[model samples]
Target: MIPLSGDIGNAKGIIRENLGTVETRRGTTTLKRGFAHMLKNGVVMDVTTVEQAQIAEDAGAVAVMVLDKLPADVRKAGGVARTASIRIIEEIMDSTTIPVMAKCRIGHVYEAQVLDATGVDMIDESEVLTPADEFHHIWKWDFTTPFVNGARNLGEALRRIEEGAAMIRTKGEPGTGNVAEAVIHIKNVNTELRRIKSVYDAGDEQDLISLARELKVSYGLVEETASLGRLPVVNFAAGGISTPADAAYLMTLGCDGIFVGSGIFKSDDAKERAQAVVLATTFWEDPLKVKEAQKMVDERQSMLGLDTKNLELRMQERGSTA
Candidate 1:
Protein backbone atom coordinates (compact mmCIF):
# COMPACT_ATOMS: atom_id res chain seq x y z
CA MET A 1 0.00 0.00 0.00
CA ILE A 2 1.41 3.38 -1.03
CA PRO A 3 1.52 5.73 1.93
CA LEU A 4 -0.39 9.03 1.52
CA SER A 5 1.54 10.67 4.34
CA GLY A 6 2.87 13.49 2.18
CA ASP A 7 -0.43 14.33 0.49
CA ILE A 8 -2.07 16.42 3.22
CA GLY A 9 0.17 19.42 2.47
CA ASN A 10 -1.85 20.07 -0.74
CA ALA A 11 -4.37 18.11 -2.83
CA LYS A 12 -6.76 18.57 -5.73
CA GLY A 13 -9.93 18.21 -3.66
CA ILE A 14 -8.41 15.12 -2.07
CA ILE A 15 -8.59 13.17 -5.34
CA ARG A 16 -7.26 10.25 -3.25
CA GLU A 17 -5.88 10.05 0.25
CA ASN A 18 -3.69 7.59 2.17
CA LEU A 19 -4.22 4.95 -0.43
CA GLY A 20 -7.89 3.72 -0.19
CA THR A 21 -8.65 6.33 2.48
CA VAL A 22 -10.83 9.21 1.31
CA GLU A 23 -11.09 12.70 2.74
CA THR A 24 -13.41 15.32 1.34
CA ARG A 25 -13.05 19.05 1.98
CA ARG A 26 -16.36 18.77 3.82
CA GLY A 27 -14.53 16.99 6.69
CA THR A 28 -15.88 13.47 6.20
CA THR A 29 -13.08 10.93 6.77
CA THR A 30 -13.23 7.38 5.43
CA LEU A 31 -10.61 4.97 6.81
CA LYS A 32 -10.77 2.19 4.27
CA ARG A 33 -7.21 2.36 2.99
CA GLY A 34 -5.34 2.63 6.26
CA PHE A 35 -6.03 2.95 9.96
CA ALA A 36 -9.51 3.57 11.35
CA HIS A 37 -8.89 7.14 12.48
CA MET A 38 -12.38 8.06 13.66
CA LEU A 39 -11.76 7.66 17.39
CA LYS A 40 -8.31 9.14 17.65
CA ASN A 41 -7.46 12.46 19.30
CA GLY A 42 -9.49 15.55 20.16
CA VAL A 43 -12.70 15.93 22.11
CA VAL A 44 -16.09 14.28 21.61
CA MET A 45 -18.83 16.70 22.71
CA ASP A 46 -21.68 15.53 24.94
CA VAL A 47 -24.84 17.33 23.98
CA THR A 48 -28.62 17.21 24.01
CA THR A 49 -29.22 19.98 21.52
CA VAL A 50 -28.23 20.67 17.91
CA GLU A 51 -26.82 24.02 18.95
CA GLN A 52 -24.33 22.20 21.15
CA ALA A 53 -23.23 20.13 18.17
CA GLN A 54 -22.51 23.30 16.20
CA ILE A 55 -20.53 24.68 19.12
CA ALA A 56 -18.51 21.46 19.37
CA GLU A 57 -17.59 21.52 15.67
CA ASP A 58 -16.57 25.14 15.85
CA ALA A 59 -14.54 24.37 18.97
CA GLY A 60 -12.52 21.83 16.90
CA ALA A 61 -13.82 18.63 18.48
CA VAL A 62 -13.32 15.44 16.44
CA ALA A 63 -16.75 14.15 17.37
CA VAL A 64 -19.91 14.77 19.42
CA MET A 65 -21.89 12.51 21.82
CA VAL A 66 -25.66 12.92 21.77
CA LEU A 67 -27.90 11.74 24.58
CA ASP A 68 -31.66 11.71 25.14
CA LYS A 69 -31.20 12.89 28.72
CA LEU A 70 -28.48 13.52 31.27
CA PRO A 71 -26.47 10.48 32.42
CA ALA A 72 -28.28 10.19 35.76
CA ASP A 73 -31.59 9.65 34.03
CA VAL A 74 -29.99 7.30 31.55
CA ARG A 75 -28.98 4.96 34.39
CA LYS A 76 -32.38 4.89 35.98
CA ALA A 77 -34.14 4.28 32.69
CA GLY A 78 -31.84 1.46 31.53
CA GLY A 79 -34.48 -1.25 31.92
CA VAL A 80 -37.12 0.08 29.50
CA ALA A 81 -36.06 -2.49 26.94
CA ARG A 82 -36.43 -0.23 23.88
CA THR A 83 -34.49 2.29 21.86
CA ALA A 84 -34.71 6.05 21.78
CA SER A 85 -35.95 7.86 18.72
CA ILE A 86 -33.60 7.55 15.74
CA ARG A 87 -34.53 11.08 14.77
CA ILE A 88 -32.69 12.49 17.78
CA ILE A 89 -29.61 10.60 16.72
CA GLU A 90 -30.15 11.52 13.07
CA GLU A 91 -30.71 15.18 13.78
CA ILE A 92 -27.55 15.39 15.83
CA MET A 93 -25.62 13.67 13.02
CA ASP A 94 -27.08 16.01 10.42
CA SER A 95 -26.33 19.09 12.49
CA THR A 96 -22.60 18.50 12.41
CA THR A 97 -20.05 17.20 9.93
CA ILE A 98 -17.98 15.68 12.71
CA PRO A 99 -18.56 12.09 13.80
CA VAL A 100 -21.69 11.62 15.93
CA MET A 101 -22.08 8.96 18.68
CA ALA A 102 -24.99 8.00 20.93
CA LYS A 103 -25.43 6.07 24.18
CA CYS A 104 -27.65 2.99 24.36
CA ARG A 105 -28.87 1.03 27.37
CA ILE A 106 -26.36 -1.53 28.58
CA GLY A 107 -26.79 -4.91 26.94
CA HIS A 108 -29.48 -3.37 24.82
CA VAL A 109 -28.71 -5.36 21.69
CA TYR A 110 -31.94 -4.33 20.03
CA GLU A 111 -31.08 -0.67 20.33
CA ALA A 112 -27.53 -1.37 19.27
CA GLN A 113 -28.75 -3.26 16.24
CA VAL A 114 -30.88 -0.29 15.24
CA LEU A 115 -27.96 2.10 15.60
CA ASP A 116 -26.14 0.12 12.90
CA ALA A 117 -28.69 1.42 10.39
CA THR A 118 -28.58 5.01 11.68
CA GLY A 119 -25.50 6.17 9.74
CA VAL A 120 -23.78 6.81 13.05
CA ASP A 121 -20.02 6.59 13.18
CA MET A 122 -20.03 4.94 16.61
CA ILE A 123 -22.25 3.59 19.39
CA ASP A 124 -21.47 3.91 23.12
CA GLU A 125 -22.72 0.82 25.07
CA SER A 126 -22.62 2.82 28.25
CA GLU A 127 -23.37 1.34 31.68
CA VAL A 128 -22.74 4.56 33.56
CA LEU A 129 -26.17 5.59 32.38
CA THR A 130 -28.35 3.25 30.34
CA PRO A 131 -31.98 2.28 30.23
CA ALA A 132 -32.65 -1.12 31.73
CA ASP A 133 -32.68 -4.25 29.62
CA GLU A 134 -33.13 -7.94 30.40
CA PHE A 135 -30.04 -8.80 28.40
CA HIS A 136 -26.43 -8.22 29.41
CA HIS A 137 -23.05 -8.57 27.73
CA ILE A 138 -24.09 -7.22 24.34
CA TRP A 139 -22.75 -9.70 21.81
CA LYS A 140 -20.55 -7.90 19.29
CA TRP A 141 -20.43 -10.83 16.89
CA ASP A 142 -23.82 -9.84 15.57
CA PHE A 143 -22.59 -6.91 13.47
CA THR A 144 -19.50 -5.20 12.14
CA THR A 145 -20.52 -1.93 13.77
CA PRO A 146 -17.73 -0.08 15.52
CA PHE A 147 -18.76 0.06 19.19
CA VAL A 148 -17.53 1.85 22.31
CA ASN A 149 -18.54 0.38 25.68
CA GLY A 150 -18.35 1.87 29.16
CA ALA A 151 -15.96 0.24 31.65
CA ARG A 152 -15.57 0.91 35.36
CA ASN A 153 -12.04 -0.43 35.26
CA LEU A 154 -9.63 -2.75 33.46
CA GLY A 155 -11.48 -6.02 33.80
CA GLU A 156 -14.71 -4.73 32.24
CA ALA A 157 -12.69 -3.05 29.52
CA LEU A 158 -10.90 -6.31 28.69
CA ARG A 159 -14.18 -8.20 28.43
CA ARG A 160 -15.77 -5.65 26.14
CA ILE A 161 -12.79 -5.77 23.82
CA GLU A 162 -12.92 -9.57 23.71
CA GLU A 163 -16.60 -9.22 22.78
CA GLY A 164 -15.49 -7.06 19.80
CA ALA A 165 -15.88 -3.50 21.08
CA ALA A 166 -13.89 -1.06 18.99
CA MET A 167 -13.58 1.44 21.81
CA ILE A 168 -13.66 1.75 25.62
CA ARG A 169 -14.80 4.73 27.75
CA THR A 170 -14.56 5.62 31.43
CA LYS A 171 -17.52 4.03 33.22
CA GLY A 172 -17.85 7.10 35.31
CA GLU A 173 -21.34 8.22 34.41
CA PRO A 174 -21.61 11.67 32.91
CA GLY A 175 -24.06 14.44 33.86
CA THR A 176 -25.18 15.20 37.43
CA GLY A 177 -22.61 17.93 37.34
CA ASN A 178 -19.94 15.50 38.65
CA VAL A 179 -17.29 13.12 37.34
CA ALA A 180 -18.16 9.44 37.01
CA GLU A 181 -16.69 6.66 39.19
CA ALA A 182 -14.98 4.86 36.31
CA VAL A 183 -12.12 7.35 36.38
CA ILE A 184 -10.26 5.76 39.32
CA HIS A 185 -10.90 2.27 37.96
CA ILE A 186 -9.11 2.92 34.65
CA LYS A 187 -5.84 3.87 36.35
CA ASN A 188 -5.91 0.85 38.66
CA VAL A 189 -6.43 -1.48 35.70
CA ASN A 190 -3.52 0.09 33.90
CA THR A 191 -1.40 -0.59 36.97
CA GLU A 192 -2.50 -4.21 37.48
CA LEU A 193 -1.95 -4.92 33.80
CA ARG A 194 1.75 -4.20 34.28
CA ARG A 195 2.18 -7.82 35.38
CA ILE A 196 0.19 -9.29 32.47
CA LYS A 197 3.17 -10.57 30.49
CA SER A 198 5.06 -11.73 33.59
CA VAL A 199 2.04 -13.68 34.84
CA TYR A 200 1.27 -15.33 31.51
CA ASP A 201 4.84 -16.78 31.36
CA ALA A 202 4.21 -17.14 27.63
CA GLY A 203 3.21 -14.47 25.10
CA ASP A 204 1.30 -16.90 22.93
CA GLU A 205 -2.26 -15.67 22.21
CA GLN A 206 -3.64 -18.71 23.93
CA ASP A 207 -1.71 -17.87 27.07
CA LEU A 208 -3.46 -14.50 27.29
CA ILE A 209 -6.86 -16.16 26.94
CA SER A 210 -6.02 -18.59 29.72
CA LEU A 211 -5.05 -15.69 31.97
CA ALA A 212 -8.30 -13.78 31.33
CA ARG A 213 -10.37 -16.83 32.20
CA GLU A 214 -8.35 -17.12 35.38
CA LEU A 215 -8.68 -13.42 36.16
CA LYS A 216 -12.37 -13.66 35.23
CA VAL A 217 -12.12 -10.55 33.13
CA SER A 218 -12.85 -11.73 29.59
CA TYR A 219 -10.97 -13.78 27.01
CA GLY A 220 -11.48 -11.27 24.19
CA LEU A 221 -10.28 -8.57 26.54
CA VAL A 222 -7.06 -10.46 27.27
CA GLU A 223 -6.51 -10.90 23.56
CA GLU A 224 -6.74 -7.14 22.80
CA THR A 225 -4.69 -5.83 25.75
CA ALA A 226 -2.03 -8.48 25.02
CA SER A 227 -2.08 -7.72 21.31
CA LEU A 228 -2.03 -3.89 21.40
CA GLY A 229 -0.10 -3.67 24.68
CA ARG A 230 -2.77 -1.25 25.96
CA LEU A 231 -5.55 -1.73 28.54
CA PRO A 232 -8.17 0.05 26.44
CA VAL A 233 -8.42 -0.82 22.78
CA VAL A 234 -8.61 2.84 21.80
CA ASN A 235 -9.92 3.65 25.27
CA PHE A 236 -10.97 7.21 26.10
CA ALA A 237 -10.90 8.71 29.58
CA ALA A 238 -14.41 9.94 30.16
CA GLY A 239 -16.66 11.19 32.97
CA GLY A 240 -15.60 13.76 35.58
CA ILE A 241 -13.35 15.49 33.13
CA SER A 242 -14.93 18.84 33.90
CA THR A 243 -11.89 21.07 33.58
CA PRO A 244 -8.99 21.37 31.16
CA ALA A 245 -6.57 20.04 33.77
CA ASP A 246 -8.64 16.89 34.16
CA ALA A 247 -8.66 16.38 30.43
CA ALA A 248 -4.90 16.82 30.22
CA TYR A 249 -4.36 14.49 33.17
CA LEU A 250 -6.14 11.64 31.38
CA MET A 251 -4.29 12.26 28.11
CA THR A 252 -1.00 12.26 29.99
CA LEU A 253 -2.02 8.79 31.17
CA GLY A 254 -2.14 7.72 27.46
CA CYS A 255 -5.86 7.85 26.83
CA ASP A 256 -6.87 7.92 23.18
CA GLY A 257 -9.42 10.70 23.78
CA ILE A 258 -11.65 12.42 26.36
CA PHE A 259 -15.45 12.36 26.49
CA VAL A 260 -16.97 15.47 28.12
CA GLY A 261 -20.61 14.98 29.15
CA SER A 262 -21.81 17.46 31.75
CA GLY A 263 -18.45 19.09 32.23
CA ILE A 264 -18.93 21.47 29.32
CA PHE A 265 -22.33 22.68 30.41
CA LYS A 266 -21.39 23.01 34.09
CA SER A 267 -19.43 26.14 33.37
CA ASP A 268 -21.00 29.57 33.17
CA ASP A 269 -19.62 30.04 29.67
CA ALA A 270 -20.40 26.86 27.81
CA LYS A 271 -18.66 27.78 24.57
CA GLU A 272 -15.47 28.89 26.24
CA ARG A 273 -15.42 25.80 28.47
CA ALA A 274 -15.83 23.57 25.44
CA GLN A 275 -12.97 25.29 23.62
CA ALA A 276 -10.69 24.98 26.65
CA VAL A 277 -11.40 21.25 26.79
CA VAL A 278 -10.44 20.79 23.14
CA LEU A 279 -7.24 22.79 23.54
CA ALA A 280 -6.31 21.02 26.75
CA THR A 281 -6.75 17.61 25.13
CA THR A 282 -4.45 18.56 22.24
CA PHE A 283 -1.85 20.05 24.57
CA TRP A 284 -2.45 18.00 27.69
CA GLU A 285 1.11 17.55 28.82
CA ASP A 286 1.85 21.25 28.70
CA PRO A 287 1.70 22.52 32.27
CA LEU A 288 1.17 26.04 30.98
CA LYS A 289 -2.01 25.07 29.15
CA VAL A 290 -3.46 23.06 32.04
CA LYS A 291 -2.77 25.81 34.57
CA GLU A 292 -4.44 28.43 32.43
CA ALA A 293 -7.42 26.30 31.41
CA GLN A 294 -8.15 25.21 34.96
CA LYS A 295 -8.58 28.81 36.03
CA MET A 296 -11.37 29.22 33.54
CA VAL A 297 -13.29 26.05 34.42
CA ASP A 298 -12.50 26.27 38.08
CA GLU A 299 -13.98 29.70 38.50
CA ARG A 300 -17.00 28.73 36.47
CA GLN A 301 -17.95 25.69 38.55
CA SER A 302 -19.14 26.08 42.15
CA MET A 303 -17.70 23.06 43.92
CA LEU A 304 -18.96 23.86 47.40
CA GLY A 305 -21.87 21.72 48.60
CA LEU A 306 -22.58 20.18 45.24
CA ASP A 307 -23.90 16.72 46.01
CA THR A 308 -24.04 14.08 43.28
CA LYS A 309 -24.36 11.10 45.61
CA ASN A 310 -27.90 10.10 44.79
CA LEU A 311 -26.66 7.85 42.01
CA GLU A 312 -25.12 5.60 44.63
CA LEU A 313 -28.21 5.55 46.79
CA ARG A 314 -30.37 4.66 43.81
CA MET A 315 -27.93 1.97 42.81
CA GLN A 316 -27.79 0.39 46.28
CA GLU A 317 -31.56 0.07 46.16
CA ARG A 318 -31.50 -1.12 42.56
CA GLY A 319 -28.86 -3.59 41.44
CA SER A 320 -27.69 -4.71 38.00
CA THR A 321 -29.51 -7.15 35.72
CA ALA A 322 -28.81 -8.88 32.43
Candidate 2:
Protein backbone atom coordinates (compact mmCIF):
# COMPACT_ATOMS: atom_id res chain seq x y z
CA MET A 1 0.00 0.00 0.00
CA ILE A 2 1.14 3.51 -0.77
CA PRO A 3 1.99 5.54 2.32
CA LEU A 4 -0.71 8.14 2.95
CA SER A 5 1.65 10.97 3.91
CA GLY A 6 3.91 10.47 0.91
CA ASP A 7 1.05 10.38 -1.61
CA ILE A 8 -0.51 13.57 -0.25
CA GLY A 9 2.79 15.44 -0.40
CA ASN A 10 3.24 14.33 -3.98
CA ALA A 11 -0.26 15.50 -4.84
CA LYS A 12 0.53 18.93 -3.37
CA GLY A 13 3.60 19.22 -5.54
CA ILE A 14 1.57 18.36 -8.65
CA ILE A 15 -1.00 21.00 -7.70
CA ARG A 16 1.70 23.62 -7.25
CA GLU A 17 3.28 22.78 -10.57
CA ASN A 18 -0.06 22.96 -12.39
CA LEU A 19 -1.12 26.13 -10.55
CA GLY A 20 1.64 28.62 -10.10
CA THR A 21 1.90 30.87 -7.00
CA VAL A 22 0.12 33.88 -8.55
CA GLU A 23 -2.64 31.71 -9.98
CA THR A 24 -3.44 30.46 -6.48
CA ARG A 25 -5.16 33.73 -5.58
CA ARG A 26 -8.74 33.07 -4.51
CA GLY A 27 -11.97 33.87 -6.39
CA THR A 28 -10.61 34.89 -9.77
CA THR A 29 -11.87 32.93 -12.79
CA THR A 30 -8.32 31.90 -13.65
CA LEU A 31 -7.74 30.60 -10.14
CA LYS A 32 -11.02 28.75 -10.11
CA ARG A 33 -10.34 27.17 -13.50
CA GLY A 34 -6.73 26.51 -12.52
CA PHE A 35 -7.90 24.45 -9.57
CA ALA A 36 -9.82 22.13 -11.87
CA HIS A 37 -6.89 21.90 -14.23
CA MET A 38 -4.78 20.47 -11.43
CA LEU A 39 -7.10 17.47 -11.29
CA LYS A 40 -6.71 16.43 -14.93
CA ASN A 41 -5.98 12.77 -15.68
CA GLY A 42 -7.24 11.95 -12.19
CA VAL A 43 -10.19 10.30 -10.48
CA VAL A 44 -12.62 12.04 -8.08
CA MET A 45 -14.58 9.51 -6.02
CA ASP A 46 -17.78 10.05 -4.08
CA VAL A 47 -17.50 9.01 -0.46
CA THR A 48 -20.01 9.09 2.42
CA THR A 49 -17.71 8.66 5.40
CA VAL A 50 -14.22 9.35 6.68
CA GLU A 51 -13.20 5.73 6.16
CA GLN A 52 -14.35 5.87 2.53
CA ALA A 53 -12.54 9.16 2.06
CA GLN A 54 -9.39 7.58 3.46
CA ILE A 55 -9.79 4.64 1.09
CA ALA A 56 -10.26 7.05 -1.81
CA GLU A 57 -7.08 8.90 -0.89
CA ASP A 58 -5.12 5.73 -0.30
CA ALA A 59 -6.40 4.38 -3.60
CA GLY A 60 -4.83 7.49 -5.21
CA ALA A 61 -7.93 9.49 -6.01
CA VAL A 62 -7.04 13.12 -6.72
CA ALA A 63 -9.97 14.22 -4.54
CA VAL A 64 -12.94 12.88 -2.61
CA MET A 65 -16.49 14.26 -2.90
CA VAL A 66 -18.50 13.88 0.31
CA LEU A 67 -22.11 12.84 -0.08
CA ASP A 68 -24.92 11.88 2.30
CA LYS A 69 -25.59 8.72 0.32
CA LEU A 70 -24.07 6.96 -2.64
CA PRO A 71 -25.97 7.50 -5.87
CA ALA A 72 -27.31 3.96 -5.81
CA ASP A 73 -28.66 4.37 -2.29
CA VAL A 74 -30.19 7.71 -3.22
CA ARG A 75 -31.90 6.09 -6.19
CA LYS A 76 -33.24 3.23 -4.12
CA ALA A 77 -34.45 5.44 -1.25
CA GLY A 78 -36.43 7.78 -3.54
CA GLY A 79 -36.52 10.90 -1.42
CA VAL A 80 -35.32 14.47 -1.52
CA ALA A 81 -31.58 13.94 -1.71
CA ARG A 82 -29.54 16.87 -0.46
CA THR A 83 -26.01 17.89 0.29
CA ALA A 84 -24.08 15.89 2.86
CA SER A 85 -24.32 16.94 6.48
CA ILE A 86 -21.91 19.68 7.51
CA ARG A 87 -20.69 17.57 10.39
CA ILE A 88 -19.85 14.67 8.09
CA ILE A 89 -18.20 16.98 5.58
CA GLU A 90 -16.09 18.55 8.29
CA GLU A 91 -15.07 15.21 9.73
CA ILE A 92 -13.96 13.92 6.32
CA MET A 93 -12.13 17.16 5.64
CA ASP A 94 -10.24 16.80 8.88
CA SER A 95 -9.42 13.18 8.19
CA THR A 96 -8.16 13.44 4.62
CA THR A 97 -5.06 15.32 3.49
CA ILE A 98 -6.23 15.52 -0.12
CA PRO A 99 -8.60 18.18 -1.43
CA VAL A 100 -12.18 17.58 -0.34
CA MET A 101 -15.31 18.37 -2.39
CA ALA A 102 -19.01 18.24 -1.63
CA LYS A 103 -22.22 18.45 -3.64
CA CYS A 104 -25.08 20.93 -3.23
CA ARG A 105 -28.49 20.40 -4.74
CA ILE A 106 -28.89 22.07 -8.10
CA GLY A 107 -30.09 25.67 -7.71
CA HIS A 108 -29.85 25.61 -3.93
CA VAL A 109 -27.83 28.75 -3.33
CA TYR A 110 -27.86 28.35 0.43
CA GLU A 111 -26.61 24.80 0.20
CA ALA A 112 -23.75 26.02 -1.97
CA GLN A 113 -23.11 28.85 0.45
CA VAL A 114 -22.91 26.41 3.31
CA LEU A 115 -20.46 24.21 1.41
CA ASP A 116 -18.29 27.19 0.45
CA ALA A 117 -18.31 28.37 4.04
CA THR A 118 -17.19 24.91 5.15
CA GLY A 119 -13.89 25.46 3.34
CA VAL A 120 -14.19 22.50 0.96
CA ASP A 121 -11.61 22.67 -1.81
CA MET A 122 -14.40 22.60 -4.41
CA ILE A 123 -18.20 22.46 -4.74
CA ASP A 124 -20.17 20.39 -7.21
CA GLU A 125 -23.51 21.96 -8.09
CA SER A 126 -24.80 18.51 -8.78
CA GLU A 127 -27.88 17.17 -10.50
CA VAL A 128 -27.47 13.95 -8.51
CA LEU A 129 -29.21 15.76 -5.65
CA THR A 130 -32.80 16.94 -5.97
CA PRO A 131 -33.10 20.30 -7.66
CA ALA A 132 -33.96 23.08 -5.24
CA ASP A 133 -35.07 25.37 -8.09
CA GLU A 134 -36.65 24.04 -11.22
CA PHE A 135 -35.48 26.58 -13.76
CA HIS A 136 -32.02 27.67 -12.72
CA HIS A 137 -28.70 26.70 -11.19
CA ILE A 138 -26.61 28.62 -8.65
CA TRP A 139 -24.50 31.53 -9.93
CA LYS A 140 -21.07 30.11 -9.24
CA TRP A 141 -19.23 33.43 -9.67
CA ASP A 142 -20.43 34.60 -6.28
CA PHE A 143 -18.28 32.03 -4.51
CA THR A 144 -14.50 31.98 -4.10
CA THR A 145 -14.35 28.20 -4.39
CA PRO A 146 -14.37 26.55 -7.81
CA PHE A 147 -17.60 24.92 -8.97
CA VAL A 148 -18.16 21.89 -11.22
CA ASN A 149 -21.47 21.48 -13.06
CA GLY A 150 -23.00 18.72 -15.14
CA ALA A 151 -23.73 19.07 -18.87
CA ARG A 152 -25.48 16.84 -21.39
CA ASN A 153 -24.33 18.70 -24.47
CA LEU A 154 -22.24 21.64 -25.63
CA GLY A 155 -25.10 24.08 -25.10
CA GLU A 156 -25.65 23.18 -21.43
CA ALA A 157 -21.91 23.17 -20.89
CA LEU A 158 -21.40 26.63 -22.35
CA ARG A 159 -24.32 28.03 -20.40
CA ARG A 160 -22.88 26.64 -17.18
CA ILE A 161 -19.48 28.11 -18.04
CA GLU A 162 -21.11 31.45 -18.73
CA GLU A 163 -22.61 31.25 -15.25
CA GLY A 164 -19.08 30.89 -13.82
CA ALA A 165 -18.68 27.14 -13.48
CA ALA A 166 -14.98 26.35 -13.48
CA MET A 167 -15.42 22.75 -14.61
CA ILE A 168 -17.96 20.61 -16.46
CA ARG A 169 -18.83 16.91 -16.30
CA THR A 170 -21.21 14.81 -18.35
CA LYS A 171 -24.35 14.08 -16.28
CA GLY A 172 -24.58 10.38 -16.90
CA GLU A 173 -27.52 8.85 -15.09
CA PRO A 174 -26.03 8.74 -11.61
CA GLY A 175 -26.57 5.73 -9.31
CA THR A 176 -26.74 3.46 -12.34
CA GLY A 177 -23.58 1.42 -12.48
CA ASN A 178 -24.27 1.21 -16.22
CA VAL A 179 -22.10 3.52 -18.34
CA ALA A 180 -24.31 3.70 -21.43
CA GLU A 181 -25.88 7.06 -20.64
CA ALA A 182 -22.49 8.58 -19.88
CA VAL A 183 -21.24 7.33 -23.24
CA ILE A 184 -24.16 8.86 -25.07
CA HIS A 185 -23.73 12.22 -23.31
CA ILE A 186 -20.02 12.48 -24.08
CA LYS A 187 -20.59 11.52 -27.71
CA ASN A 188 -23.27 14.18 -28.00
CA VAL A 189 -20.89 16.82 -26.65
CA ASN A 190 -18.12 15.64 -28.92
CA THR A 191 -20.30 15.69 -32.03
CA GLU A 192 -21.37 19.27 -31.27
CA LEU A 193 -17.79 20.29 -30.58
CA ARG A 194 -16.66 18.97 -33.95
CA ARG A 195 -19.51 20.71 -35.77
CA ILE A 196 -18.67 24.04 -34.16
CA LYS A 197 -14.98 23.58 -34.78
CA SER A 198 -15.70 23.06 -38.45
CA VAL A 199 -17.92 26.13 -38.54
CA TYR A 200 -15.26 28.26 -36.83
CA ASP A 201 -12.61 26.95 -39.19
CA ALA A 202 -14.80 27.91 -42.16
CA GLY A 203 -15.21 31.42 -40.68
CA ASP A 204 -19.00 31.28 -40.88
CA GLU A 205 -19.81 33.91 -38.26
CA GLN A 206 -23.53 33.92 -39.09
CA ASP A 207 -23.85 30.14 -38.65
CA LEU A 208 -21.93 30.28 -35.39
CA ILE A 209 -24.29 33.00 -34.12
CA SER A 210 -27.21 30.87 -35.20
CA LEU A 211 -25.81 27.94 -33.27
CA ALA A 212 -25.42 30.12 -30.15
CA ARG A 213 -29.04 31.18 -30.45
CA GLU A 214 -30.14 27.63 -31.03
CA LEU A 215 -28.24 26.48 -27.97
CA LYS A 216 -29.71 29.31 -25.83
CA VAL A 217 -26.25 30.50 -24.88
CA SER A 218 -24.27 33.62 -25.77
CA TYR A 219 -22.60 33.79 -29.17
CA GLY A 220 -19.28 34.72 -27.58
CA LEU A 221 -19.26 31.53 -25.54
CA VAL A 222 -20.01 29.50 -28.65
CA GLU A 223 -17.23 31.22 -30.55
CA GLU A 224 -14.84 30.65 -27.67
CA THR A 225 -15.64 26.96 -27.46
CA ALA A 226 -15.33 26.64 -31.22
CA SER A 227 -11.95 28.30 -31.17
CA LEU A 228 -10.70 25.99 -28.40
CA GLY A 229 -12.29 22.94 -30.02
CA ARG A 230 -13.48 21.92 -26.51
CA LEU A 231 -15.33 23.16 -23.46
CA PRO A 232 -13.66 26.20 -21.93
CA VAL A 233 -13.14 24.39 -18.65
CA VAL A 234 -11.92 20.92 -17.75
CA ASN A 235 -14.51 18.23 -18.60
CA PHE A 236 -14.78 15.11 -16.47
CA ALA A 237 -17.00 12.07 -17.10
CA ALA A 238 -19.31 11.43 -14.14
CA GLY A 239 -22.05 8.97 -13.14
CA GLY A 240 -22.37 5.28 -13.92
CA ILE A 241 -18.69 4.53 -14.45
CA SER A 242 -18.06 1.22 -12.60
CA THR A 243 -14.85 -0.39 -13.72
CA PRO A 244 -11.28 0.05 -14.96
CA ALA A 245 -12.41 -0.32 -18.58
CA ASP A 246 -15.16 2.23 -18.04
CA ALA A 247 -12.69 4.81 -16.79
CA ALA A 248 -10.25 4.16 -19.63
CA TYR A 249 -12.96 4.34 -22.29
CA LEU A 250 -14.09 7.79 -21.14
CA MET A 251 -10.49 9.03 -21.16
CA THR A 252 -10.33 7.93 -24.79
CA LEU A 253 -13.53 9.88 -25.44
CA GLY A 254 -11.83 13.19 -24.44
CA CYS A 255 -12.69 13.59 -20.77
CA ASP A 256 -10.00 15.36 -18.76
CA GLY A 257 -10.73 13.09 -15.78
CA ILE A 258 -13.21 10.67 -14.19
CA PHE A 259 -15.76 10.93 -11.33
CA VAL A 260 -16.89 7.60 -9.85
CA GLY A 261 -20.05 7.96 -7.78
CA SER A 262 -21.55 4.68 -6.47
CA GLY A 263 -19.05 2.82 -8.60
CA ILE A 264 -16.59 2.43 -5.75
CA PHE A 265 -18.07 2.18 -2.28
CA LYS A 266 -21.13 0.30 -3.47
CA SER A 267 -19.01 -2.31 -5.14
CA ASP A 268 -18.31 -5.63 -3.42
CA ASP A 269 -14.59 -4.78 -3.58
CA ALA A 270 -14.36 -1.07 -2.90
CA LYS A 271 -10.64 -0.92 -2.20
CA GLU A 272 -9.55 -2.99 -5.17
CA ARG A 273 -12.02 -1.27 -7.49
CA ALA A 274 -10.88 2.18 -6.41
CA GLN A 275 -7.22 1.40 -7.00
CA ALA A 276 -8.01 -0.18 -10.38
CA VAL A 277 -9.96 2.87 -11.51
CA VAL A 278 -7.16 5.26 -10.53
CA LEU A 279 -4.64 3.16 -12.37
CA ALA A 280 -6.81 2.85 -15.48
CA THR A 281 -7.48 6.60 -15.60
CA THR A 282 -3.78 7.42 -15.31
CA PHE A 283 -2.68 4.98 -18.01
CA TRP A 284 -5.69 5.01 -20.26
CA GLU A 285 -3.58 5.62 -23.32
CA ASP A 286 -1.79 2.32 -22.77
CA PRO A 287 -3.77 -0.83 -23.47
CA LEU A 288 -1.42 -3.05 -21.48
CA LYS A 289 -1.62 -0.89 -18.38
CA VAL A 290 -5.40 -0.70 -18.53
CA LYS A 291 -5.53 -4.48 -18.93
CA GLU A 292 -3.37 -4.92 -15.87
CA ALA A 293 -5.59 -2.58 -13.87
CA GLN A 294 -8.67 -4.45 -15.02
CA LYS A 295 -7.16 -7.65 -13.78
CA MET A 296 -6.92 -6.23 -10.26
CA VAL A 297 -10.66 -6.37 -9.64
CA ASP A 298 -13.40 -8.94 -10.19
CA GLU A 299 -16.24 -7.91 -12.51
CA ARG A 300 -18.83 -9.72 -10.39
CA GLN A 301 -17.92 -7.48 -7.45
CA SER A 302 -19.10 -4.33 -9.25
CA MET A 303 -22.32 -2.61 -8.28
CA LEU A 304 -25.41 -4.02 -9.93
CA GLY A 305 -25.92 -1.52 -12.75
CA LEU A 306 -29.22 0.11 -13.67
CA ASP A 307 -30.52 0.63 -17.16
CA THR A 308 -30.80 4.38 -17.84
CA LYS A 309 -34.06 4.12 -19.80
CA ASN A 310 -35.80 2.38 -16.90
CA LEU A 311 -34.67 4.76 -14.17
CA GLU A 312 -37.50 6.33 -12.17
CA LEU A 313 -35.53 9.52 -11.69
CA ARG A 314 -33.48 10.96 -14.52
CA MET A 315 -30.92 12.81 -12.44
CA GLN A 316 -29.13 14.12 -15.56
CA GLU A 317 -32.12 16.20 -16.65
CA ARG A 318 -32.51 17.99 -13.32
CA GLY A 319 -31.34 21.58 -13.72
CA SER A 320 -29.78 20.73 -17.10
CA THR A 321 -30.91 23.97 -18.65
CA ALA A 322 -29.68 27.44 -17.73
CA lDDT of every candidate: 0.63, 0.88
The TM-scores, one per candidate, come to 0.76, 0.92
Count steric clashes of candidate 2.
0
Give one clash count per candidate, in the order shown: 13, 0
Q: Residues 22-78, candidate 1: write the lDDT tens digits.
A: 553321112311222455677887787788889989988888877776454554455
Stretches of model 2 off by over 4 angstroms after superposition: 1-25
Q: Which candidate ranks first by TM-score, i.e. highest?
A: 2
TM-score of 1: 0.76
The residue pairs found clashing in candidate 2 are none
- List per-candidate RMSD values in Å: 7.6, 7.2
